[model samples]
Target: MTTEIIDHEEVHAFTIRKEIEIAAPIEIAFEAILDELGADAQMPDGKSLSMKIEPWPGGRWFRDLGNNAGHLWGHVQVIKPPTLLEITGPMPMSYPAVNHVQYRLKANGNETFLTFAHRAMGLIQPEHRDGMPEGWTQWINQIRERAEQKARG
Candidate 1:
């Protein structure tokens, strides 16, 4: 499971990579990321945010808003179950901006080493770009917590 995110380094002006080691198996970690939240999925504050992933190359990872109006977060560019997953064309960015996200996992003893990277190019919105790393850190943390908890169950 080897891959890298390429970019320059001025914060939002380049690619961002965040890594976390979780106390869970790679499979658990991977599943935690790919599992679809049912239609009623919502943010912690109750805002609608449906999420699902098909977990296969060329599969879709998206948020399904009601009435079929949903955001195409990205397409699974590559998937080597429990090890690597790459997605391209994510949203929260429109035309003139494109994003690529990758999640790499490696089993270590009984846990998993997870690496997440997001690369964006084009006219990135200042606010969006500014919050990306932090946003992704929070997102990855939440998923890590879930994976660890599931492992203990």
Candidate 2:
């Protein structure tokens, strides 16, 4: 059987949100995200891309090269450690795009509820646009695992 392909009507902005409840405290969960995004989100080569987050408002988040020569991933628009973090910029995208992502966490007794939103506006390619939903879910699960492990030890 042949597969049906969807046709694009126009270029549009896309927004995606994902959430997970980690069996760890808010601090642990938040740190897990920071660590994961900067290092643990794996690539095809069994290794993760390098990243550096400034961790404060007006700070920057980007690929970290040893000699400070790297691409700018985004800038920290808002930051409230263990609670919220927001970024805005071009991200890792090559196209002319605007990207924003937010990480929010809330403490419920011992466990922490983590949520994030990723929004991209530009001429998004079909391949890049289609894969995000599942990709982000996997990334979140990985972060959750790291947080839980940190909490345990």
Candidate 3:
């Protein structure tokens, strides 16, 4: 077998962080996060992904495709109601990589500050890296919309 060495740039890691303010309480924002990332998960085009999060330490975060077939996105490393959540796993990478995602919430009177971060290392592909920011932003926007809608009701 022949050995091939990859370029340093091709194997580099990355981190993405985004902070958004929601016109909703911390609890509502947190619940919106769970909903958007879990049962209410969807593609940019609004197609449901049927995702699920067990919501406890060591719980599974995955997409259920039915018939016992699905994709394991990650495991809940930490979960604190109305405050923080951290998960570790492949998370849509599906390759020789490790990923950690965190959602932190802070309450400010009647508003909430939501901070999200995703860090990964390994053979991450160009397309995945390029698309992640937009994809994550879409999810974040959805969470904000959901929370704000509930708050307005």
Prediction 2 global C-alpha lDDT: 0.85
Angstrom error at residue 150, model 1:
0.4
Q: If scored against the real structure, what TM-score would every candidate get? A: 0.83, 0.86, 0.93
lDDT of 3 by residue, 40-151 (tens): 9999777899999999999999999999999999999999998999999999988889999999999999899999999999899999999999999998999999999999
Best by lDDT: 3
Candidate 2 vs candidate 3: the TM-score winner is: 3
Model 3: lDDT of residue 60: 97
Residues 77-142, candidate 1: write the lDDT tens digits: 998988988888846676566788888999998899999888888767788878777767767877
Per-residue lDDT tens digits for candidate 2, residues 1-153, read: 899885654666999998889999999999998887676657545576777777888988888767858888899998888899899998777777888999899999889998889999887777777887877887788889999999999
Quote the lDDT for 62 in model 3.
98
Ranking by TM-score: 3, 2, 1
Q: Considering only N, C-alpha and C atoms within 3 Å, which residue pairs clash in candidate 3?
A: none
After superposition of all CA atoms, the RMSD between model 2 and the true structure is 6.8
**TM-score for candidate 3:** 0.93
Off by over 4 Å in 1: 1-13, 36-48
Query: All models: lDDT?
Result: 0.78, 0.85, 0.93
